[model samples]
Target: MSSIKAIVDQKLILEKMEGKGGWTFARVPKTTANTGKSYGWKNLKGTVDGFKVECSLMPLNKEYWFMPVKAEIRKMVGKQAGDYIQVLLYAEIQELHTPEDFLLCLQDDPQAFEHYRKLPDDEKQKYIDWIFATVDEELQVQRMADAIDRLSRNEKLPKKVLSAGKPA
Candidate 1:
């Protein structure tokens, strides 16, 4: 139930329930610096700490809308083109809530108004959350079903392999 403080005016705040199991956000992979050698060695590393949930503002009809956006979930790992990643929804404000109502109030006369305007549009579409199911206790039930299917197929999998990996 930990919540991050965000500006209600300049950004939109949204939440997705981690349910009883909780969740982790992932970081996008970064390109490596050139070594200036003929051997082209590209670095490919995955980061667990890079994932985060953020609120962003999007311009709509001369106004702005706040939406919750998720970044860096493990489900997106090794995703290829045309592949789909699953996301789970938590919660959001149905109506506009002003900055004054934010738990962490906007700083007193916080920076120039233009600063807010210069902010980037990183908000995700509203419907994206509709596609993902919550990462809940039910995941164990689903895993058990998958394991049973694998076992029936005569695949020699180690016991509890499905639950060994990270949870989204």
Candidate 2:
């Protein structure tokens, strides 16, 4: 079995995906300038989690800039482009969180608690981590639970609990 290699950094991965629109690696034959003879090959590379990757597209799209492949090849492993053609790099996956998990971390302030409940999963975790790092542990736990309870009751946190503090 072949294993892929990658570097894992949340921020960096996001940045690369944003810049490239997706990830892809390619290999092409090199030609001699004078005789037009094939001199071997050259590879184009990209990454995810710091690992090099190659993928095949489900169907061929010749006009598209990127093509999909059967399997992804990282820097550590090598694969011929024609071996299993049709590769295209797609968008990166983002992490999601559940309401229960979100609630468990919002105990610091009921209003901030409600504010957190309304946020998207990614934003909620970012905020939760920020709050957890700065507030007292006990308060963090309490706020998380309180936020959950408020949701269950279909009620919002009081205005006092929503005040902002120094950055975490």
Give the C-alpha miss distance for residue 145 in model 2, angstroms: 13
lDDT by residue (1-168, candidate 1, tens digit) is 233222221111223436764322221111111111222222222222233333222322222222223333434344322333332222232332223212122222233222322332211111112112235546534533433343334333342442343222
Across residues 113-132, which tens digit of lDDT does each residue of candidate 2 receive?
66555665544554455445
> Which candidate has the top score in lDDT?
2
Identify the runs in model 1 with alpha carbons over 4 angstroms from their true place. 1-52, 55-76, 94-168
Question: What is the number of residue pairs that collide in model 2?
Answer: 33
Query: Clashing residue pairs, candidate 1?
Result: 12-66, 16-90, 17-90, 25-51, 26-51, 26-72, 87-132
CA-only RMSD, every prediction = 24.9, 15.9
lDDT of 2: 0.38
